[model samples]
Target: MERLFGRAWLVLGHESQVLAPGDFLTTRMGREPVIVVRHVDGSIQVLVNRCAHRGSRVCEGPRGHARQLVCPYHGWTYATDGTLCALPLAEGYDRSPIGVEELGLRRVPRVETYRGFIFASLAPDGPSLLEFLGPLRASFDDLVERAPAGEVEVAGGVFKHAYRGNWKLVLENHNDGVHPAFVHASSIWAARNGAPWDVWEKTGLWVARYGHSWMGDYHDDTRLVAALDHPVFREYRAALERRLGPERTARVLGELRWNSLVYPSCSFMSQFRQLRIIHPIAVDRTVVHAYSFRLKGAPQQMFRDTIAFANVVNGTASPVLTDDLEVYERVQDALTASRNEWVELGRGHGGDVPDRDGTLRGRTGTSEIHIRNQLAAWLEYLDMGGPEGRADAPAMAPQSAQRSEAPRQSRNAPRPA
Candidate 1:
């Protein structure tokens, strides 16, 4: 894998993470360490956390409010905008070119906000946030608007997990609705007491354009739909109706069950009200952050149900996800061996019918079409000159994996539309 910024989506943090002035957050995209801060003037900024004086990290904590990014080594202070606003000594050297302006922290090439979510791009060129989001914008709007209060906040903290496999596997898993019936057969069966879950039969699986796709929509399936029709969903719909009116409530809630993948590295399973982050630490080892979201103005039980679902399905302790983790780990270990250069993606080969917007649909949930969609985005990033290219035109490429093996490509790889 290559680290090309243009070919892939690199910026990952959202604006809501830093709400108050002086609020700061530390995170990494691809390989760059980022510092997101709400400056004194109440504006948000993203800059490289490395200090100009010496190549040392400026921010030490995950998140906090700070007076300034004080480099503890020499007490060098920088403003939230990455400007070198203060110095400890007046005259350390007679003739120094280290002017405050020259020594300001290096800011990322691009930064922007959508709704309240903040994002930064280390690369200078590619799709703007709106262009990049594509169909995802509507899904995100629904995620926030469906709430009675029309706002969402991070809650229940974040759960960090690791898998000994490529981060792409997680993306493939997220857009893969078919796997639940088989990969999660144990849990699904147990949930249904050995009876075949009807939702499994009539799953409303969809693979949308631009690498966005979803699984797990059987809300109308008489048997499996019963699960969501319970008091929790009913109350949620009622509250939403009061806030947005009957039409809007029906539009958001009764529309669909969307467990979606945001191209490159984000997952929002709307039903669960959980958002997961996939941070590629290394080719083989990836970090997963599962954050719970509270629907603003929704009932306490609604929020509690969101948390419970996170714990029951997406949490590290989840019976369903534990098996997934194990499978991912196993896949990583096995791919290291020498047998073939390509992994199997022929599950629904030649059968994917093109959707209205050029997205390909699979015959069933287990089809590898979702993985194919993700790899299309991955390859596009690689083709764009990836992270190693010049500053003017960034390219997208996969960050290299630790072990050496020819990067696999599918035999029936669809021509990306």
Candidate 2:
């Protein structure tokens, strides 16, 4: 765990989560709890969730608009900006300064926002979010740029679920396209019970640089492609054709389905209109948060289609996801056996092509290239030393109750990117 935390990229929330003044949310970095808040002055701040007074936590709620964060332990109150505000029954000591600044919440060392998402680094130095995003940034821009409104937000409440497997398994599965045909046989059968085989085979899947991948031509269900295709999907293709010309649009649209593993934690299924975040809980447990977004300015049917897609592919009860989860859990269980020294990542090992960027890519769905890339990043982050070094192991477990406000200092700090 120390090795894992040492070089871990402790990125938490994006800037859009705290859009309004007093809007705040709590997230964890490793085992440390962090509170991100939009201050009264309209600035965003990230702080530790621990209270300065009596070492008790400040806020206990998950999220809410609050002018002040009042600690329930000793009645210590703090302004939204993390300034220590009021303590009950003041005026006991005249010789000392007990003002807000003195007791202000502990602030994260470095905070940066990229593309409206906020990130903090516990370490004073590391790659910026843009640098960290690397090849994944282009994929994110492509998704948002396709939107006529050129913006996206977390639309509905997030769906939080737990996986009884190593977090890495879930991360690897995000871009693993090979499992769909075999593991998702039920879904594929249901999707094509009355449809044609050629159309199903025509649906293209693509793997991108640095573990980012997607499937394309999803609408080629023979039924839909036999028609003119949905107007919105048609418009999306047409606009791309106009911008990049017919040949390029054919190349781009014919390739790629999901845009996932945006480095470190986040994975986006652009076509499904949902993003899934992988949060590590322990050696054998992971908490996944799935967020669906309403594409701003998109047709209502588009959002509905996205929800339906989510239900079919990403829902907890979906045949595809259920089988995948079973495999992951079994893998975790098997790895604990005495025989296996390391999980094999040897598939499609040397076949990766070096792109213009420094990242590597493998062509086939059978490749474990994405898993290799993720482990590479994970190893790099864990070597840098982190919260696990503290005398007291950070509370990596989930708190039974939600916490609202926390001290800016003494909380877990962000790790390098």
Candidate 3:
């Protein structure tokens, strides 16, 4: 876990989260607490959340705007840039050799941003942010390009859901096309008022270069939404095309799908009209943050429509998510008692082909390629330290659950060119 944290770029917060100086938000990089702050100069900084003095955490609330951070335990204070500003009693340390430089909040080694998404890496020498993102870069482009200026901000607040299951379960479920029909049947039934499943035969799964994947329909199915009385999707597509041009618009809204899992940290799903961040609290527990936003040049009604859909499908206590949580917990529980070593990744597993662009395309809607991709990515990250260290141990298995399974698929998820 430590090696994984050290080796990978971790998303701390969006640039919009800290628009003003002294603006800061607290989050975790692996298990360590981290703070993302905007300095007085408008530059962003990410620092380890702990106070250098006595190792107590400096930032307390989830987010705040303060001239300086003051540790509650003692009077130690630091500037927004994390420079040690003051210690309540200077005489206590007069004879000692300790200096202000060493006491400043520790900065995360490698911090970088793409569009407005800020990410940090604890290890200094690994891949740059762009290098790490690889083919998954297009998804980020697709996201921010939805706005007129080709940018986006974190808006509409965060929708957080907590569940008792291994974080891997959520990863597996993100692009698991098969489970949606079965797991979300009641929710879909209610949404469509008990109509039979609208599973589209035209749908497919995509696996991108770095394990980013999703399952979505080939195009908007007007019949699926006709009963909902929401005819806005057509006009929305028209609006996007008019504003972004046919090619750019196609890149942004043309695909018309959901669950673009951006590797280990985030998933952007337009089907629910939100970007989700998956935070692993422990092996057996996870928290999901769902942020819904509006496009800058788009109509106000568009934002409202998106949020309305999100409220129905991904909102807290959502029928769809509620069902998903129940099943995740059930799986976790069953795994605790099962004698089986490897769970199945066999459902519609092998009908994948590679595209000319090097993406893996799964022929079946219910293919397990996405789960298989994520599991492999997870293991590859865990093996960063090589065979001599923690990699040799079966730490990927949660103490409360049984062993996990991962396989390989060569095709990749597509991002707009």
Candidate 4:
């Protein structure tokens, strides 16, 4: 945790969660509780939630508006910016060398936002958030641009669930295009009468630096957001065209990307306007918070579609998600009992080609290249002797050039039957 999450930028929440001064949301940055609050100065502050007087966490609720943070233990109070403001029995510390000014809740070393998504880092120095995001910034652009008013905000509350599995499993599963056919077979069989699937054929996989990856649109307009001819969709498109013009609107709507991973933290679907943040509690336990976004100027039906998709895919009662949760737990159990240290991820190995944008494109969407890319990043961040260890080191090199070295087992292994 210290090496991977402590040193890396992790998404906290969206800027919309704390729009006004004193608006605040409590979340975890890899198990450490923290508060993302808007200050009186009109700036966002990421403060450690632990009270200064003692170690008790200050914020218990998920989110709210607060003029100041008061510790429940001893009534020690702090301002929205994390300044230590008041505390009980102040005269007791009169003779102490340390003053109350030195006891403010520790602020996260760095905080940044890109396109209303907030991120904070515990490390004092490293690559800026922009450099860490690399080309994945375009994924956020794709999301916000779909908003007719050129902005998006969190809506419809959150869908939260806990699974008895490692957090990495879900992150890996999201971009593993091969799993939905089998993992979601029950749901598919009930919905589609067991039709043969060919989602990967239309999808493209792209991997970027710093472990970021995303899948191109697998579902066409007809399946993705109702038919392009649907009246609500037509209205949504008209609204976008007014702001972005007809040509730009056509280009935006034409782009079809699905799940995108921002590495070590969050995965989101621009098509459905859903964002899921992963929180690791222990090696065998994980929690996820799923949120839906509303396009600023889009029709109400559009947001309704977002909610319906969330219920079907991300909600706790979702058969699709429950299927995945069961599989994740089973995999975790198997992994705990297995003797082998290595799990193969060789699908489409050595077949990824470089794209014009400096990213690697998988030969097929079914490739496990996304998982491999994530593991490579995991190794990089965990390596105390690697670039992440040094304060001045540059970000990891693009994984495209590293694909030449295939795993030894993959070279000699027989193709799967």
Among all windows of 10 consecutive residues in model 3, the one with the lowest summed lDDT is 408-417
What ranges in model 2 sit over 4 Å off?
Answer: 1-11, 93-102, 193-227, 232-257, 384-417
Per-residue lDDT tens digits for candidate 3, residues 228-285, read 6565756655666776787877655555555777777777765445787778888788
Per-residue lDDT of candidate 4, residues 1-417 (tens digit): 888888778988899999999999999998689999999999999999998777999988999998989999999888888888787777787554233556988899999999999999888887899988877888888899999999999999999999999999998999887787898898888898343447674478888766778998666553454544688888888899999999998888777788999889899998789999999999999999999999999999989989999999999899999999999999999997667976888888888877846688877888888888877677667654222456554443446325424532222212111
Runs in model 4 deviating more than 4 A are: 95-101, 193-197, 222-228, 385-387, 391-417
Cα-based lDDT at residue 248, candidate 1: 76
Q: Which wins on TM-score, candidate 1 or candidate 2?
A: 1
Structure candidate 3, residue pairs in collision: 207-412, 207-413, 208-412, 208-413, 359-411, 359-412, 360-411, 360-412
> What C-alpha lDDT do the candidate models reach, one value each?
0.69, 0.62, 0.71, 0.83
Q: Which residue pairs collide, candidate 4?
A: none
The global Cα lDDT (0 to 1) of model 4 is 0.83
What TM-scores do the predictions have? 0.85, 0.78, 0.85, 0.91
Model 1 vs. true fold: TM: 0.85
Give me the displacement of residue 127 in model 4, in angstroms: 0.9
Candidate 2 — number of clashing residue pairs?
26
